[model samples]
Target: VREEAISRSRCFLNSAMAFTLYTYPNNYRAIKSLIAAEYTGLEIVVPDEFKFPGDVRSEAFKAKSPVQKVPVLETPDGCLFESNAILRHVARYRPEANLYGGPFYEQGLVDQWLDFSAFELEPPRNVWLYPILGYMKYDKRAAGKARNDVEKALTVLEDHLLLRTFIVGERITLADIALGSALIAPFEKVFDAKFREKFTNVTRWFTTLINQPEWKAIVPSVSLCEKEQIPAFPKKKEKQPKQQKQKQQKSQAKKADDESAPPPKKKEKNPLDLLPKSEMDLDTTKRTFSNNPFPAALKIFYDAWDPEGFCLYTSSYNYNSENTVDYQTSNLVSGWLQRLDSLRKYAFGCVNVWGVEDSKGPFVINAAWVFRGPSVPFEFTDCPDSEYHQLASVDLKDEAQKAKFEALLGGAEKYDGQPLYERKQFK
Candidate 1:
């Protein structure tokens, strides 16, 4: 019966139809599926309209993917989410490709490696690379531990690949696709020559995989890391107290009349200070939200909100696929909010990290901002950390958009059917 079921499955795949894959550009998860398609001759269409977080957040996309994540395979039968599952679906299209391996035991081995890739390899890889790539804030101690973990995982692979050409068998299987794709970011970003020296076997195996025609077909180039890349730290600004600032002004005034004194410097005004007052009482709104539950807080917020004087905007982290560790992602949000301190008087916002951490997360980030202007404040956009976010103006007139904003602001346990992992309010 088992054998018959397997035969039936293969028969169905043999006549497999085309699939549309929804994903963002340079998504490694999509790469795995594409590479598998190359091997099995599966037609996977990635629609140009299916963009990043926006499309994924739409009602249509949510219907297909309740969790609202990507690498969703739209098949004639139904839709499939999750990259590994999509890769496996593509791989099974041509039984002759043997991407899942032939014998039952070999198939089990492939599954093992795939599980290993996800459980052991990918987590450390993400932890190590995310910081360097600026997706997560750099933490010396966390990074050090992550590097050690990656080294240990690679050591295991090194021994396994010592005498074998591929992970499971002589031919490339889903295991190779999983592990190879998992390592691509690390090898290109963090695993420098010095680091690669110890894992000669794993390096050789990885090199062989990328050089293959199928890999080359999907991924035209693979640039191995030569020198280690370091994270760029932000500079901190020191704030002086009012009394200290007044004393400094007095001291500077005395220097103004001196023979060698330079001309007084003009004080630069904030661009936002020039805007007409919104009269929204943002501080009161923040306090109301903090002090009361969702219903009462929302009522206070709605009463104070002046659509003509203020604007609502939404933003999501572009590199959320790299958001693995809960603490690290929280820190990423913290860092951004800290930089946004200058906007306290002019902005009220909520940043939510959806999906739990320490799991397979391409965690989703949803942020809602209410600014005392017609658009996003310059101070918010001017920050270096702002570049990683995809910003869009929100139309509260649209009920759906308004509800999403409310969810973020009210600290809802779930948004668009996905559970909220953490929420931070910026007042």
Candidate 2:
């Protein structure tokens, strides 16, 4: 199936320099390209799972495009990695599309705003908002800085839109698409009723442009909560009663003492403590293990010992057909074993597995997993075996550490059948 998809994609290689977009669904840059493609009547195919440039570290992708970022535009002439570059290329292809602008200088203005949208606006919003919304992961200090920077940018945008209808030209152009994508983040996640109310012009401009038929073709609808009034930080209140004030002072004194005192060392629990507590005694009559016990055990292992940093999927099994059952069960077991084997080395903290059911059948599927870091959900997969095998790359990163993790899994005294997991070290 994978080979067939790749072969079919090669057909694009022959045509007017096929445009392939490597993007994730929620990615702002990817969405920008999607909007551009829609306006230009171009087709852009996005890969299912988008790995971070650092994560994949693929030499081939890097060689073709130095930046190694998503929303990559692959053409017969050359590969363009950045989102803005791809948008420009698509716009230039259909100059009559009116997505860029009429005059050459107008196009330049649109380009200027596009640059500002990416460099000036998007970065700050991503830094501040992505972490808070649990999209990307970052430290608290970094997240705080991003939040402040995003607010400053928002205020600037608000000021600019006070009279202007659009960011660059009167008509919707490349600038609107670029800036609008970034702006959607704030409107969807950050701006409350109060903030929108305060920046009425910005709100009006955003509403007018995003609702346009062209933009809607790509973005569909910008997700937003009801406009909320921005409340003052550390809200004001009336003075408390005398007794309440006294109690607060006492609590503050205790807090100060706790802060000044040396932290107590924690005694680690026995390795056995890692396993889940004994299952509650349930009525077996209600839910008997109909199929092989292995499937249930596999499900339990995935549910418990999921690797901390990779995605996972469950396999479906068939009882009546030996060929189907054997192939499915073996693949499922092998996948699980491989993942367990990998985590024994470059140990992450934990893995999350999501179960997938069949489209229409009595056969309930127990397959699906998404690996999450402590901070962000990184990888996702529908193929359990593929995700399981991919763990080897992680294991190979540190041999000694991998061995230690292997010992934990193999050490019958500790893991038994429980899936062992770990957390990554944070800076």
Using all chains and alpha carbons, the TM-scores for the candidates as numbered come to: 0.61, 0.48
Model number with the top lDDT: 1
RMSD versus native structure for model 2: 20.0
**Candidate 1 TM-score to native:** 0.61
* lDDT tens per residue, model 1, 1-427: 5345545654665577657899988788888999887777666778887678778767899899765788899998899987788888887766677899999999999999987887677776777787777666677777787788889889999999989998998888999999998888888988889989999999999999999888998788999999888888787888999999999999898877565866689999877678677767777878887889879888877888788788888887877765766655776788889888878888888899888656666577879888887888888878877866888787878988777777776558886666788888888
Q: Which residues of candidate 2, in runs, are more than 4 Å off?
A: 1-18, 49-55, 135-145, 227-427
Model 1: runs farther than 4 Å from truth?
A: 1-38, 41-86, 108-112, 118-120, 130-142, 159-165, 192-194, 197-201, 208-227, 232-280, 284-324, 335-342, 354-357, 361-364, 373-407, 410-420
Full-model lDDT for every candidate: 0.81, 0.53
